[model samples]
Target: MGWRRSRSSEPHADLRLLIERFGWAVEHVRVPRRSTGTPSSYTVGLTAAGHPEIVVLGLPAPVAQDFLNAVAEQVRAGGSYRPGQRTGEFTDEDGPVVFLRVEDTGGLASARDVYGSVEALQLVWPDSTGRLPWQPGYRNAPGVQPLLGQVP
Candidate 1:
């Protein structure tokens, strides 16, 4: 199927097209260090495929894109996940990553605008020393990887 650009003022025609073709689309937001927040990326359209959308914080745009893409692929292939679960599918070298329910959707404006009240999860990765953000001596700053949901 092909996507026709709608006349609405929404500027996500490209995102819609990508979702139609690939089951999901990744959106990477890069904020300068001087800004209030670090870089983040999220998936759009996963809700349409019967899966909750995903978000990754504090990673570079390219890395986040690849990570989200891999997750989307697995979800589309009948894989299931839940908040507080750990998996090594994405980063086996760094050990398993944790998934948490995103209680706040304010940062996922694109997914909300497209799907309207969609469920989302945060894929939290660990530091180089295999310590999660909640653990002591984690490398990144607090603001660098803000959690939008409760710790599981």
Candidate 2:
């Protein structure tokens, strides 16, 4: 499927696609605010259990990677990562889910709280220019995917 053109419009539509494809849910209400940038991103409760995960600060891959790498470095220094859970809106409803986080990014003080710190990593994947677009209608976009009725 294609990416969304503008997250502000029909943001949930793109989020739904992400859930269907990436198994990640984006909560509309919990979207972070008061960011250092426009079209900002807040910590998306990466996990269904709300244990803290990746920071969803609207940013491109390179910039996000920098934040991630920095946090990763912090993790390597003495933190850790795990399959943690966080509470969030799933398919527009509350539910449990999972995602990956740095475990810690605030240096030694938060070393033990790697997962929480991971929530604080402050990374994001933003497309401010609407450079990409969610399929005009996902139904029209076709590609390799779950095969038709093969008996689950």
Candidate 3:
């Protein structure tokens, strides 16, 4: 299917298109919020069982990598994440899952750039879980660490 664009008044059209392109059904698109550099902050809601959500925050170029790495490590280790006071427990009945946080230029967003960011997230889709959503059968077969090597 081709990329779907939201109405002119709607925001995060590119993010919506990218999320859909990844094959994960989009459940909701929260209204964009005001940001410093970009016109608005975007969040793409997913229909996954665990209520997964993806938000592209407007962070400075320098700390973006560190932030991504820190979040990845936290999620991998099953620790409480301080981002907005939400615990970083990435999991559901299927197994542990991660919320893909991608960094992008704090400049104006374009369909091309959003697509690129989504692509980057796919490269690390499962984070440290080492399992995809479709691999639940295999993941539960035997000798599998459901929580990506972390207990509970």
Name the runs in model 3 displaced over 4 angstroms. Answer: 1-56, 82-152
Query: Relative to the true structure, how large is the alpha-carbon lDDT of every model?
Result: 0.84, 0.33, 0.32
Give me the overall lDDT of model 2: 0.33
Model 3 whole-model lDDT (C-alpha atoms): 0.32
lDDT of 3 by residue, 2-121 (tens): 222345554465545545564321212223455223212222322221222233232332233333334434433553332123233433333343433233423223423434333112
Which stretches of candidate 2 lie above 4 Å from their native place? 1-8, 25-45, 49-51, 56-62, 65-152
Ranking by TM-score: 1, 2, 3
Local error of candidate 2 at residue 43 (angstroms): 6.0
Give the number of the best model, judged by lDDT.
1
Model 1 global lDDT (CA atoms, 0 to 1): 0.84
Q: What TM-score fits each model?
A: 0.89, 0.27, 0.23
TM-score winner among the candidates? 1
lDDT of 2 at 116: 35
Total clashing residue pairs per candidate? 0, 18, 0
